[model samples]
Each structure stands twice: as structure tokens, then as C-alpha cells.
Target: MSLRTLSRNEVANHNTPEDCWCIIDHCAYDLTGFLDAHPGGCVVLAQSAGKDVTVDFFNLHRAEVLNKYRPQLIVGVLQGEKEEIIPTNLQDLSSVPYAEPLWLRARFCSPYYTQGHRKFQKAVRRFFAENVNPEAREKELDGTYISQKLLNKLAETNILAMRLGPGEHLYSRRLLGGVINGREFDYFHDLILTQEFSRSHTRGFQDGLMGGVCISLTAVKQWLRDDDLRERVMEEVLSGRKKMCLAISEAFAGSDVNGLRTIAQKTPDGQCYIVTGTKKWITNGMFSDYFVTACRTDKGISVLLIPRGHGVETKTIRTAYSTSAGTAYVEFSNVRVPMSHLLGEEDQGAKVIMSNFNHERFVMVCSTARWCIAVVEECLKWCNQRISFKKKLIEQPVLRQKLARMISLAESIQAWLESITLQMCKMDYEEQGKYLSGPIALLKAYSTTSATEVSSIATNIFGGRGLTETGMGRVIEMFNRTNKFDAILGGTEEILADLGVRQVMKVFPKSVL
Candidate 1:
């Protein structure tokens, strides 16, 4: 059915409290009923009545707000007008400068991204924009875990397996409608997926959505002694029938993995380990079915797969981001984990734990870099549109400099990230732990530091809206509040810097001055 067409005069004629109409992006909205329920209030709607409110509406409201209320509010299109330039679909990439990476921009070419990468990127972006973004926004605010329905969709599409990064794990699985063959997947594809997933822009909820499976399942796939046991665990978690988290941090230990006090004593019959420990700040723990946990044993600190069962308990731990992450304080009270659950050598679990860390931090870098650019894009849009003191924010010299700095930081970090990602593609896991750890560490440290700076500059650009939880500047506010998680979660900025330097020092040559 054709939508009714209204002329400027027709829209103007309804300009009253009882019959309010306004034009936004060449579309007429019958907001007569919505006025009372408008978040900004009826006065604002009444004032906007009978006018083309495209500028005013976009200045204060995000495109998403329009998407949410459009069905009920929209009554017709402005006669003889077209909205060809308006960007309404969240699934499409932004035209705003620096909104996307260089490779994704028109007329820009990269040696890294291939045809498959482009196709896969589009598919993944559409999937999140359509399937995940709605739920993430709701869950981020409500402090709920990822819904099973979404997880099932993700699993059915093999997205969960892809998040574990390219390997045998991806073998035989048709990924995202077979846009990319699993056998040919590489770290670049992994990078693409991680960045796309983070683009959901819901920080804590991003973590809540099967993030644990990404970090924990790799350890199970690599170090579990029994192949059957390992495959079983992987199938369960990746299929979304079961959930898992990496349990390494405790009250007494975080960066210092050796300081863990969690104890695991062997049973008399050698059937299981009686594990007793409390793991703090575990992502996705609140709803996890398996915990790839670190514990102290007869020999030394070791890693084990502790299933959630009798004597296992989880308590929520609220953090700077939403509790949607399921960050929890977990207690294992004499939990009986079978001998078959041991990962790697009993005492050499540090090796297994260390194996996952490089990739974990690499994933963190990918997320942080993408998120920084997303914020830069947000600031760019706001500066271009938001007027202050008789001019758009972009017209000011200081704000321009801030935008310049934000852009430089974001671009440099992404470049470094891509460099490291390519090296990861070339190296095996052991080789990566040996060669790329320091560079990745340095990259993550710099990435997070850049992110912090970007967020700070964005807040200044957005002013009061940067502090708001809704409206045009909400993206800026979200990044400001949660960008620090990158610096803290994988490893502290200071600790990573030190590690990066230490890695360099390991091969340093002695010199006489």
C-alpha cells in the first residue's frame, strides 16, 4: 500500500497540541498521541509541530530512536520529497569519514582483505545489526545474560566456532552460509569477526554473549588429555547447549597467575580432584555450565575443567560496565572434577594458561581498536551536526584538533592491530607465544591507551550528552564509561607494557659504552 503524502501546508495545518505533525527526513509523523509519552516531553513535540524537524531531531536523537518509534509514529511521506541520503538501516556501513576502516571505504584498497573477507564482513554485520543489536541494547540496560535464543542462532551459524579463531575447530562447519570455507579460515577472518561483533556497541553485553566460550574452549581443544573428552566439551559449549568461562583471576591473584590460592587435592582412588577455590571477576560465570579453571595442586598451579554441579556456586559482581557480562565471584566448595578433566600436565597448566593469554589479549586489542574507531565516527557525526554558539561544533578550532587527534589515534592503533594480526596468521600458536607476544602486548597497551584518549576527546566533543545514557551522545558516554575495561580485563596497561619490554629484554644484546 502506498503511504499517504502530505504537503508542507498539510503538515503545517496539523500544528497544534491536539493534532501534532512534524517532518523528519521527509517523512511526516503523527505524534499527536506520542507527545505525552515522548521522552523529551510533550512541549518539545508541540514546539516541533508543523516544521521540518530533520535537523533538530537528528541533533538530539540517534537514528536508532527513530527506528524504534517509526512504525507507530510515521503517517506519511512529504509530498514530492525523497530521503535518498538518509542512513536508516543500521545494517549498512556509515558514509561518515573514518566510520569504517580504510579497507572497507570506497576506492580504498588493501592487500589484506579479500573478496571472501568483504562478503563475510557484510554477512556478519547484517547478522548482528538484525539479530543481536536489539537484544544487546535491552540486555545491557536490564543486566541480563545473553538469551538462549540468540546463542542458538549464533551456534547454528557457526559464529561461536569462528570466534575461537581459525583452526581445526572450524573444520567441516559451514560458516555464515558458506561465505568462507572453514578449512581456509585465517587470523584475518578472526579479526574481522571480532571487530564486527564489538561493533554492536553494547560493551558489557558484548562480553556476556558467549565471550567465555571464545577464551575457554581453546584451552579445552588444545590441552585436554583425552580427545573424546575435549571434543565433547567443545561440542557442548560451541553448540550453545552448555556455556563456559575462563576462571583465572582470584581475589589474591590477577596478573600474577602463580599467586592463585585455589586448591585441588587428589582423591584417594585417583578418580578426581577435590577442588576448593573462589575465582573472582569471571566473565560469563553467572550462567556458565563449565569453568576452565586454574588451581593449585600437589605439584604446582594447574588448569582443570570444573563443571557446574553440586558444591559449585556463583555470585554476581557488578563492575563499571553492565552486569550483563555475568562477571561473577565463583566458589567451588570441594567440587569433584574427574581426573579426565585435567588440562595439560597436572603441574604444567601454566603452559596451557599462557597459550590462551596471547590470543585473549589479541582479541582484546581487536575489540579496542574497532571500538575506538566507532567512537571517532560518533564524534565526527555529532560535530558535523551539533550547533553551539551559532556554529556547528566542527567549525571550532579546538574541537577540530580533538577530532584530528581522535582520528590519528584510531587509525594508528588499527594499523598496528592489522600488522600484528598478519603476523599471527603466519605463525603457529607456539611461535606466536614465542615471537608475537611482546608486539601484541605492546599493541594492546597502546590500543587501550589510545582508546582512553579517544573516549576523553569524544566526551569533550559531545559535552553534556557525553555524560548521558541516551540520545545522540550515548555512544560517546558508553565508550567513556567502559573503554577502560580493555586496559584492565586482559591485563593492566602497566603490566602489559612491562611484559612487552621484558620480552624485548629477553633477546637484548650486551653493549659496552
Candidate 2:
């Protein structure tokens, strides 16, 4: 066979000659230099070196490598080849990387305990001060004031740490700082979760909390291994270097732990599992770096980390929220992941999943409660400023009564969340493992539904302006979107209510008997 020549697209995109042709089994193959950037390793590329290993490539490497790294590499044309089977794993190379700084890693990774030590607090405070201010008019139009502010904070934290070259330990510290220093980090967290950072901090709290769930999951998974995937993910998360989202919910399943339809069955070769199914209502579904997804495996339900691209198609769905962190309908048609990507044992995914849900639910409650507090504060501020017929809205007894009720509702949720958060802080994983599932469900249900009510009251108080996009109008929009999401994601209110019933049933029967 004559040596195939490289296509203009492939030749232009190759980083180096060593990375020129990724040969698979001596067919003189070229896969566009995706191996080096592969989170799994360069070995995946090495395995495919030298031949027309096309069949093996399609069966083994297509979904695994192409989907995740296609955006980064370029495949040159082969000599004497009639048709080039563009790898099934290829991604669109159209997306551009955000020009964020390297120091973001250090800020994100820095430990909370040490944030006050040395100049860390000062530096972080300065970072937030510089970035968290309300935006200029031009900036405000392009991005929402809240989102711009939060992004500024996120960018500042990410860029500074990255420039400082802080390691993973420090990066973790920064993540804690963002979580604990409510005043400084909470806004950004809210923005991150709700994908509405550009809209209103209070409204975006749910999205930020959702993002936190994925972040926490990444952290936990990192703790499970010391490999390159762990290192890369840690580096990305700590420095705010990479953006990712989770895919846990499916079309037919919504908090029904055992009803997942996505399957990760082992291939006949026993080398990998062919993951096939559609994941719906996935947060960050459209724009995530990789998906930490739950799929039914032969051993049970298992969580697998699948990179986006290739055959893993994503379709964005319009929702009440406009931020479009790109909630998507993801179809994994025969997507394959090696055994290494499996989180925990086969079929035992429920145990790992349950544990994660607890943290997720707790964070969601705390964040949503915070949003309610913010909404109440905003309403109070608005009431103070706007006067009707020579009197402030706060002066009206009816409005006062409504505000009081809103405040009370917010406080109730906050008190419960604080109590639960404190308990969470005290328990070891093993201890938490024992009691988290049920209470978490209850907390999520209570907080989200309560937040929705608070948002509605706040909107009513704002009247017509609440329906617009000016002043506190943004807050109303965010609150409305988050209110809907709160009852859905993590665990639905109905699901949690059912869980509460089950919990009560388990205990109440004994007393009655």
C-alpha cells in the first residue's frame, strides 16, 4: 500500500511531527494528536499507532477518544485511501478557550483554614474587591451585572492562583474559601450553579449549588485515585481552569434511584462497557468538559466519567432560565468507556450515588436558602426606595405583612440548613454515610419549595416591574427559574416527600405497634 498523504486540515493542525500520525496497528493511521491531551493517557494513542486499525479504532477508540478530544486535534488524510472514516470520537473544533489566567488554580485549591494565614486573605479579598463590583454600562449590556461580577470574582480567583503556581493543596484551600466566606464567595457560587451569574446572585444560587454538586463529585472522585485523570481534573477545578457539568438525570428517572435506564454493559471483549441511553435535564449538559454520569452496569448502577464529543450528541432545551449553561438531552449511542472510568464497583452505583446525593442536597438547601435571604433583602431595599402617593411600600401594612412572612419563611429554612450544615461538618464520611440519604431528601424538598414561595411573594411585591428586566426585575426572573429547578434537580420535592414518608413509616410503625 502506498503511504497515504496528510490532508490540509490534518497537516495544519498537528502540534509536532512525533504527534503527526497516530498509527493504530500499522495501517499508518492519523488520529489528529488527541492522545497527548487524553485524560486517560498517551497510552491510548500509543495503542493505535502505525496501521489501518480502522475497525478496532471505531469499535474501541471512536466514542472514547473522538468525542472528548476531537475539538483539540486534527487528522491528516491517508495516502491511497478512498474514504476517511472521520473518527466517531471527533468533536467540533469550533469552540474557543476562555483567556483566563493560570493563578485561578491556586485560588481555587487554597485551603480555607490557611486563607487567613500569610497574605492569602488579603490577596483574595483584593481579587474579589476588584472583580465583584457592579459592571459598567457597556459591560452590563453584554453580560448581566450579577454574572459579570461573579465571573470577575471567579476569573480573579482563578487567574491569580494560576499565576502564582499554587499546587493542588492550595487550590483545594481556595475552593473551601469560596464555600466558607459566604459574603465573598457566595455570589460567585450562586452564579456558577444557576448559570445566571450574569443575572442576579440570589436567583443563581440554585445553579451555583448544582455546580457545587459536580465540583464536590469531582473532589470525591479525585480522592479515590492518584492517577493523571485525578491530577488533571484537580488542576482544572482548583484553578478554575476548566468548565464541566454533571449528567445524572435521565428521561424516565427523576430521583428514583433504581429507575435509571442508561446502561453500561461489558463488551464481548470484556475490555470496556458499551454505554447507551439518553440523559435528560442534565445540568451543564450543553457546555461541560466531561460528564460524571450514572449508568446501569452488569454489576449494578455505576458512575462513569465520560468526556464529551464524538457520538455523544447534545441538544439544548429552552427553559425558564436564559443563562443556558446548556441543559441538554444527551444520547450515548454505544459510547464505550474502559473499566478504569467506572466509579465504585459494578451494580453498586446506588451506594456511591446515594452518598453523593446527600452532599448535593445539603448544598442545594443552603444555597437556595441564601437566595431567599438575598431576595428578601432586595425586596426590602426596593420597598425602601420606591414610594407611592407620598409613602414607601414598606409603610403599607399589607406589603409589610407580606415581607414579614417572606422573612420568616427564609429564616426557617436558613435555621434548618445551618443546623444540618453543622451536623455535616462534624460527621466523618462513614458517620455521614449512615444518616445522610433521608434527611438530605427532606432538606432539598423543604428548601427549594420554600424558596419558590419566597420568590413569588417578592415578585408580587414588585408588581409589573418584577416582570421586566430592570432594577430588581432580574432577581424576579432568577427566582422564578430557580424555584422551578429547586423542585426538580438533586431530588424532586415529591421524591423527597415520599422519602420522608418512607422514613416516617420505618419508625412510626414500631411506635404504633
Candidate 3:
């Protein structure tokens, strides 16, 4: 199809009863009565009116634009012609099937180390330029970003559809069942798993918009197996869909299995557990479908899949990272969950919770490494382009030294992660069950700390502009949020550090000296 291009002002003035327009892409669609439900404020639709926006829509808004509105609500023409631009030398070859493909793609694409690699580096650069812009890639959450076909399929499966609009609570609920639904799974997986697709689909904002509901939901489904309860929870997730979060944090305890205070007292009728306590700094706490919470039981600490409604109160908490899946201070007032909703067994909640963290930490480390790498690359690109003292910043000896240090740090962490992942891939469930705790803690602590340092150095390199939310500012924001997240989620840095020390001691008690 031929994609038609039009200017913002030109399109704004050409609005007709039969035409609808997308300001950022400058694509038009027919939306005569669609203005009423637009979550981004009608001005967005009115601004684009009847125009085409293929020029540079990303440059017009801040990176948070996608996070502020639902992209699906903004309709556009599918019949427009595709414009051909000069293709870069870099390309994504990972999707191509090969019988004896070289490990080069995986190596270069490794979030930690991509430098000195030709094809992979080039692909990475091209992917960033095309997808990472604020307007096109980063924006407030909007419903328009979701695929209708997938939504329809979900609806057909008895799943209620809640169109996620931007600025709502992120990561409030756990999504279940959709993984088996081919279309829905592929659509959602593309957003969470790939950087290239994420940028094009504005998934960061969606992640921020949905909070971590998708991942949390996936985890819950994996951990819980009751067909009826799972369906009920899935309905809740699909209902509000946009503003939900999972809470794993507790006051006075983190990453320490024995330190939890929230108690689940068993009742006579089918063993009900009354939970009461405060869970601090929970992601998506401000708004969440329900919490897959862990609490102490008579047998041991157990996991309770609790839905949010009555008896659960939350307050939004401010932090170093402003954009979030919606972090919150949560308090459970005698909340109760039936024995049927309990994940695994009593006191065995630790196992369930611990198991989730292993995979979660791995994903976080990969993403954190990717963020750091992206920051370094962005800083380098900026330094090369910006002239300082009659020479480029890249020409400065000190800058080169800093860049080298950052690269080295990233590479070291990357290597450790890769080695561990390889090890994990080979281990059986029994072996993994025993071997994962220490490594997971160590990796989380190491990667997060490294990300913090890399981001700080990258910001210093950028000078004052780095502090603002523009230019390479999004990288700074991502680093800040992700770094803090690394310390809090999965396991806190302090907790992990202590665990690492204890694990070593357990292995060699006599070598304490």
C-alpha cells in the first residue's frame, strides 16, 4: 500500500466527517465518532485532524508521550502507501533460520558486550535510531498500541478486555492463559522480549503503562494451576488490564526467606489465611488487579494469590525514578485467601517465590545490561558528534579513559551472566533448585551496581544536558529507574549481598579467615 505523508498543520485543517488522522505517523483513518473515547485528550486527535505525519513525529514530543496516552485510540489509514527511505547498512538477521548459523549473532547481540563486532554492532545502531526516539517509540500508554486481532481473540476466550490507557497504574494485575493463545502471546511477547520490536511498538511506555502486569501474570499462571481460580484471575487482569502491578516487597524483610512478618493464620473452613502487614515499595501498588503475595503460615511461609479490592489499601510512593509501573506503599488489613488460592504448600511459598526470582533476575540482568550498553553507545555517539575545545569529546584523553572503563565494566558483567545462563540451561530441575539461589543473588547485586556506575559515568560525560529529559536524557531516566529497580525488585542489593556472603560461608565454614 502507498503511504501518504502530510504535515501536522496541513492535516489538522483537513479534518472531515469521513477522515481520521494519527499526528505522529501522519496516517489517517475514518473516525467520525471516535473522538469521544480518546484517552489522550481530544486535542491529540484534533491536532493531527486530517493530516499525515511521516516527517518526524518523534521530535515533536518528549519521550514520555507514549506513557501518557493509549496509542490504540489514535486511528490511522492502513491503505496508505509505504514510503521507502535509504536503508542503513545494518540489519537484524536473528530472525533468519540457519542450519549451522554462527554464534556471532548471539554474541554480538549479547546485551553486555557488542563492541568490536561488525554486523551485530551495525544492527544494534540501526535498531536504536529507528526505534528509540521518544515520540515514535516512547510515549504515554494508550489503547491504540494493542493489536485488535489479539484483543478479539482474548475476548473470544472468555477473557474480558480492558484497554490500557496511558498514565494508569502499571503492573497491577497478573495476566494468565493468553500464552497458549498464539496471536495474543506473540503480540505481547514481542513487546516484552525484543528491543527492536519494543521501540517500534512503544512498549516501554506500555510496560510502564501496564506496569509489569503481563510478566507478573505470566508468573502467576506458571505458579498456580487451579483452572477455575486461574480463569477468574485472568478475567480480572483483562478487565482493568492497564493499571495493575505485582507486589513482592515487605517491610523489615527482603530476599530473606525467614524474615517475613505478614502472617497467614489458618482458619477452620478449608484453611483460610488472614494476612495483615505492610508491603513497602511495591511496583504497581498504586493500582493493581491483585497481589501474588507471600506470607508466613504455620507450615512455613506460603504464597497467596490475593486479588485487590476491599481490605487492601495503597498509597503512591515517590522515588528517584518517577516513571514506574507505579510503585506503592501497600497495607493488607486482615486480607484472606482460600486454601485453594494458595500457591504450592504452606511454608513452601518460599520455594515458589524463590523460583520466580531466578528467571526474573535473569531477565532483569539482561535488560539492565542492555540499558547500560545503550547508554555507553549513546554517550559515545554524542561525544563524537559534539565538538569541545576545538576537538570532539571523543578526542579527549580523559573521555576515552572513561569510555574504556564503562565498556570494561559492561563486558565483565556480561561475561558472568552468559556463563551463568549457560550453566542454568544444562542443569536439571533438581540441580537448578539447589544451585540457583547463590548465583541469582550474586548476579542481581553485580549487574545493578554496574548499571548504576555506567549510567553515572555516561551522565557525567554528557554534562548538563544529561540531567534534562531530552536528547540522550531518556537513557539517563531509564538507567536511573532501572538501577533503582535492580536494587529493589527480585531482591534488594543489601539482601543479596548478605545472602551471597552466607552462601559462601555455608560452603566453606572453616575458611572464614
Candidate 4:
């Protein structure tokens, strides 16, 4: 509905409980209907009726609160008042300093993003902001699974296919609803997807919705030998008709692959294998119809494609984050699978697993970097408007220092990620597996460790609200709870750091003094 301009005297006329009105930052809001629902009670609105409440509103609430309620409450802007143009365009940089990547800011330039990339980014961001974010928030709060309607939206828009990363399936496929063709997709596009989608502010539900498919499907597409079976699985998942997950970590093993106890024994006929094992902390396991499993074999460890059926069990594992992720403890009891389900050669589970690490760790880097930025955004927004000691919080030098440090860390990690992504775009899969693993691991380690510090300072800025589940610090609260996930998941910082050094040492120059 179009709003009409209202004069101050006109606003003053609606001054009773039956027709209450208040001006917030020069915008008139008809709160007559909301008086009884006001948390502060009717007297507060009654007393402020017919008066400008801009100062009083800022003193009590964050700007986002106004954004959240404006659509419903706003009636008109005061005559002669110029409304602030808060941007809704996905490509527009937030006028707030350090809120977006430097390249997105006005007067900045970059060789990395093309017109097509920009279009793709805008389309995906708009989709998430309008559709995914709202549902993600609801599902995260209620511990409900992602709706099939949402999945259908993702499928029809080719988002599900895009998450699998660039592959044969993308050939001739329309991506971002035709914003870009699938063949044009690269690491930059993948990076854009991860970063933009993280804006949903519902981290756990983000994983619950598509994280499993993103990580697990790569292993299937790259290693699985049966072309027919692989195609079938891919079609099912890309259509959003079936769910899949990677079953790797067991209670006895996390980073240590050799310590896994899951076992697969080949039949005497050599046509099948009986798989028995348990996987713990499996993302998306609770709802997956297919499990890409890791198991110990006669020669060594092996990878198998196990369809869910009899003797397969999954129980929800509650986490610091929400249960919407479908985190699970899974058990397999002598489940039979065709030998054709083997991924890559037998006893080569390590190789199969390694195939996914570069992409996985890179994705972790993208997520943590964006998540840190998100926390910084929350701090900046809160500090700018929050009143304390008769002054805005940002007026304090100490708070500015915190923001400076957080922005530096967030921007630095993003620069490193962009450099690495550029290399990923140029390198072949084999080359990435060979030379990029250590660097990717190190990037993840640094980004997530940086995230730890960012989350801490941001929470300090938000104070009690940072700890609260709702209101001004909602994003901060979620980040604080879930930020540690990146630090430990994929690969731990200590392990990745050591691995990076070890990898470089393998090719270190002997003559270097």
C-alpha cells in the first residue's frame, strides 16, 4: 500500500487509546491496534500518543526492531521529512562500514567478479532473503525439518544442483533461475553461494537444509564406479526427492580416519558386502535415504554406498546448535550392499575421503568468514544506536577498537579466501587434491580460529542481548553457540596447522638456510 504524507498536526489528532499514533524518526505509526499487544503495556503508547517518539524508541530498541515492525505499523512519513534509504538490493554494499566485502563498496573494483557473477549473486541473495531466511528462522526455533515446499523451490530453481558444485549435471542446466548458465559456474560461484546463503542468520537450519548434499554428493559423483547407479542417485537428490548424507565419523574416530571401527566384509561370491558399523554426529543422517559410508575392509578401509533399509537405524543427537540439522547417531547391522556400490578401489577409503577435503575445508572457510562478518554486523548495528552513559555506544573508543579488530580479521580472512578461490577456479581437481589441500586446511584453521575471537568480542559488545535468543542480539547469540563448529569440524585447527606444515615440508627446499 502506498503511504500518504502526514503533517505533525494531523498525527497529533490521533491521540487517544482508540486512535493512538506515534512518530518514530519522522514516520507516523498507527499503534491503536497494537496498544494491548505492546510488551511495555498500553500506558507507554498512551502517554506517547500524538508525540514524536524517535529519541525514546532508539533509547529502548535496535534499528532492526523498527525494520521488523515497520511494514505493519507504518502509516506515513511526516511532511517535508526525507526518509533514509536503507538498501534492500543484494548487490548494494551496506553503507555501514565493514559490513560487506571491499569489492562491493562504491568506488571499489575487482577482476574476480564478472557481470554474470554479480547477477548470479544478486539472484541467489534475493531468493534467500525473501524465502529461505523466514522459514529457516521458524524451523530453527521449532526443531522442525525443512519443508518440502522449500525443497521444491530449491529444486525448481536449480539451487539443489548448484550446491553439488560444478559438474556434468550442470551442463546445459539453468542456474539461479537463468541468471547464469551452469557451465559458467566455478569456485567463485560456489563461494558466492556459501557466503550469500549464510546471510539467512539461521546457521543450524542452513546445514540441515543442504549441507549434507553439498559435501556428500561430491564423493559420489567423483568416485562411485557404476555410472547408472551414480546417475540415479544424483537425479534423486538433485530433484530433492531423496536425501543423502556422509557417514564417516564414529564415536571412536573423528579426525583419525584409521581408528574407525565400521566394517564391511565381502561375500564369498564377491558380488556383495555385509556392512556393519555405527556413525556418530552425522549431519542430515536422521532423514537421509542413502548413506555414503566409510568402513574397514580386509585389505584396509573402504567406502561404500549403503541404501537405508533393514538393520539401519538413526537416532537424533542434540547439539549446541539446533536439531534442525538432523544430527544423528547411526547404526548398521549386517546390511547387504552390492559390490558395485564400492567407491573407488577397495581399501582406498582414505583416498575417497581425501577427494572431498579441499571442497569441504574451503566451504568451511567460506562459512566461518561470513559468520564472523555477520557477528561484526550485529555488533556494529547495536553499537551505533544503543545508548549508554548518555552517549551512543560507538562514541566509546574501546568499542571502536573492538570493531576495528573484528573488521580486520573478517576482511583478512575474506581476502585469503578469494585468493584461494581464484586458484581453485584455475586448477584441475587432481591438482587441487595434490597441492591445495594443505593451504585449504590452513585457511579453514585460520578463519575458524579468527571466528572464535570475533565471536567473543562481538558478544562482549552485545552484552546480555548477545546471550539472548531473540531481539537485537539474535544473530550474535546463534553465532556464539555455533561458531565453534567450524573450529572443530572438517578438521581441527591443530591438526590442519600441522598438516599444512607437514605438506609443505614434503616439498621443502633442502638448500634453504
Best by lDDT: 1
Model 3 scores a TM of 0.63
Q: When superposed on Cα atoms, how far off is each prediction in RMSD?
A: 2.0, 23.2, 11.7, 2.3
What order do you get sorting by lDDT, best first?
1, 4, 3, 2
Q: For model 2, what is the alpha-carbon lDDT of residue 226?
A: 33
lDDT of 2 at 503: 68
lDDT of 4 by residue, 447-466 (tens): 98899899899889888988
Give lDDT tens digits, candidate 3, residues 1-513: 444454445456557544655544324443446666655466565555665543433323332343344244444333354423222222443322210012333533443222323333344335344433333333333312233343343344322222221111223322233222322222122212333322322323424434456446654655676778876775666654433455666778866657878777877775777888778777666656678787877867788887786788988676555433356788889887777877776678777876666665666665565566566666666666566687778899999998888887776775676677666656744465578778868887998888788878988887776776544465665565446666667778888878777776777757556
- Candidate lDDT values, in order: 0.90, 0.56, 0.57, 0.88
Candidate 2 regions off by >4 Å? 1-129, 132-216, 219-228, 504-513
Q: Which residues of candidate 3, in runs, are more than 4 Å off?
A: 1-211, 225-228, 231-245, 255-257, 480-482, 504-513
The alpha-carbon deviation from the true structure for residue 467 of candidate 2, after best TM-score superposition, in angstroms, is 1.0
Encode model 2's per-residue lDDT on 179-280: one tens digit a residue: 333223321232222222222354332243225324344433533343776666655654454555667778788777578899888888888878899988
lDDT of 3: 0.57
Let me know the TM-score candidate 2 reaches against the reference structure.
0.63
**Cα distance off (Å), candidate 4, residue 472:** 1.1
lDDT of 1 by residue, 1-513 (tens): 368988989998988989999999999999999988987789999998888899888778767688788888888998889974354577788888999999999889988889989898899999998899989999999999898999999999999999999898888999988888999899989999999989988999999988898899988988998889898888898898999999999999998988999999999999999999899999999999999999999888889999999999999999989999999999999999999999999889888988788889999999999999899898888888888888899899999999999999999998988988889988998999999889888999999999998988888888898999887777889999999988988789999999999999998878831
